[model samples]
Target: MNRLIVTGASSGIGLAIARRFRRDDWSVINISRRPCPEPGVTNIPCDLAQPGAADGLADALSPWLLDRPRLCLVHNASIMQSNRVDTLGSADLRATLELNLVAPNAINRIVIPHLPPGSSILYIGSTLAEKAVPGVAGYVIAKHGLVGMMRATCQDLAGRGIHTCMICPGFTDTEQLRNLIGDNAGTLAAITGLSAFDRLIAPEEIADAVAFAAAAPVLNGALIHANLGQRER
Candidate 1:
């Protein structure tokens, strides 16, 4: 079976992806700050929002390294603070980058060597990378950085038989989204109104896209948009 490490697996899209992978009998290493209750999902609790957290996570999972020849790394952990740059503090900026960009990059750097020659790395991204979402500057910046990282990884890993792909999704119905919008009903309404679909994309739909990318052997350096035509690339 294929072995995959998925960050942010405690809830939302991450949890959904983990569940789907487990159901497919893939060995799943679920990394998150909180523990998930899903059976067959190996929990690796680590805060991806800390500078040193990624290294710690890499060390923790080292012993469980698979004997197989392929390792799929899915980076889905991110923290968002919806506020303009003028209103946001240094701490907010650091927190957002640490979770959304820095830590994932660090984790990939440390873990890349352990992945077999033909392994693949999947970066979860957002449509905000291309469009200006008013209140989420930091998030947009980080995701944009992630896109660059994915492309660079694809180039660097090409000769090694390793591939990189970015999976960008529009607004999805997930626990994290619920938390973000529950506090501001009007903002949520405005966001939905901006969407041509008038509804949040399902987490399962995102998970399916991820699985498809993981299994597609020839999809190296591909940016798979799962936004239902919300933001075109």
Candidate 2:
């Protein structure tokens, strides 16, 4: 069976990605702080916010990767608290960079060698990755760096038939958003109405895009913008 490893698989887009692969009978391994969403999928508990978490993820996944003909690794776990550029702290920036960009970089190094030909590496980015939004300096910077990482990975590994792509999703109606905005009607309306239909991006929609990227042979080194014209450049 084809093996799939997805980080932050306990919730949101990551959960959706894992579920999509599992639905197709792929062997799904999830790494997250929370418990597994389903019984069949294997869950590796991790706190990506902690230092060395990236190295730990790579080490923990080594055993499951043996002799696999096909493999997919999705980096989706990320954390960010509201902080403007003017108010951002050095520690907060370091933590954000570590989890959102640095850790992914390290984990990629450890895992890429074990992947055979035809493997896929997907990085989950944000609309903020290309565009700057006030009050989220850390997240914006980290995601932008993630895009660079994805592009470089593609160039570095494409010759070996490994495909790397970055998928950037717009404002999504996930529980994380709920936690961030709470019951604020104005913020909710503004975010959800970013699209032409005035609806928030769904986790399943992002999952669909990921699925497409995984299978599209011509997509190596591609950077896809999945936002519904939100903050379109």
Candidate 3:
């Protein structure tokens, strides 16, 4: 059976991806603080933000290293803070980059060696990755770094039949979005209006994009925008 390792699979878009893959009969490994509770999904409790947290991923996955099947690595967990550059602390900025960029890169180094020829890496980015928005300086910069990392990885592994792609979503409806918007209902309204549909992007829709990228080998190294035309880049 094909195997998938998804970070931040406890909820939101991550959880949806976990469910989607499990339904397709792939062996799903979930890395997150909370358990997925979905039948057949193995939850490995982890906090990606902590120092050296990603270093252990390979050992946790060692048993499956030799399973000898198609493999996929998905980086879906992230932290977003709303603060202007002048107000963002160095500590906060470091932590954001650690989780959003460093952890995923470490996981890539660990898992890439064991990935079979058809393996793929999926980096979940955001609209902020391409364009800056007010009050989210760290997130925007880190996401931009992630896109660069994804593209670099794609180039590095392209000759080995390994695929890497960045999927950028726009204001997806999820727990993270709720927290990002806080109790300010108007902020949510304003974000939704950025898309032509005038609604928040669905986690399921992002999951579908995930499925599409995973199945299409020709899309290797592609930067796919699933944001419904929120911003053209």
The model with the greatest TM-score is 3
lDDT of 1 by residue, 140-180 (tens): 88888888988888888878878778888888888878887
In candidate 3, what residue range of length 10 has the lowest lDDT sum?
224-233
lDDT of 3 by residue, 1-233 (tens): 99999999888999999889988899999988888877899888788998789888777878877876899899999988887898889999999998999899888888888888888899999878888978889999999999899889987887888888989998899998898779998988888888888898889899889977887778887788898887342
The CA lDDT of each predicted structure is 0.82, 0.85, 0.87
Worst 10 residues of 2 by lDDT: 224-233
Candidate 2 vs candidate 3, TM-score winner: 3
**What TM-score would you give candidate 3 relative to the actual structure?**
0.96
Q: Write the per-residue lDDT of candidate 2 for residues 88-176, one digit (tens) a residue.
A: 99999999998898778777887899888888999999888888878889999999999899989988886787898889888887778
How many clashing residue pairs are found in candidate 3? 0
> For model 3, what is the error of residue 125's alpha carbon versus the real structure, in angstroms, after optimal superposition?
0.5
For model 1, where is the 10-residue window of minimal lDDT?
Answer: 224-233
Q: Which of 1 and 3 is ahead in TM-score?
A: 3
Best by lDDT: 3
What are the candidates' C-alpha RMSDs? 2.1, 1.5, 1.5
Ranked by lDDT from best down, the candidates are 3, 2, 1
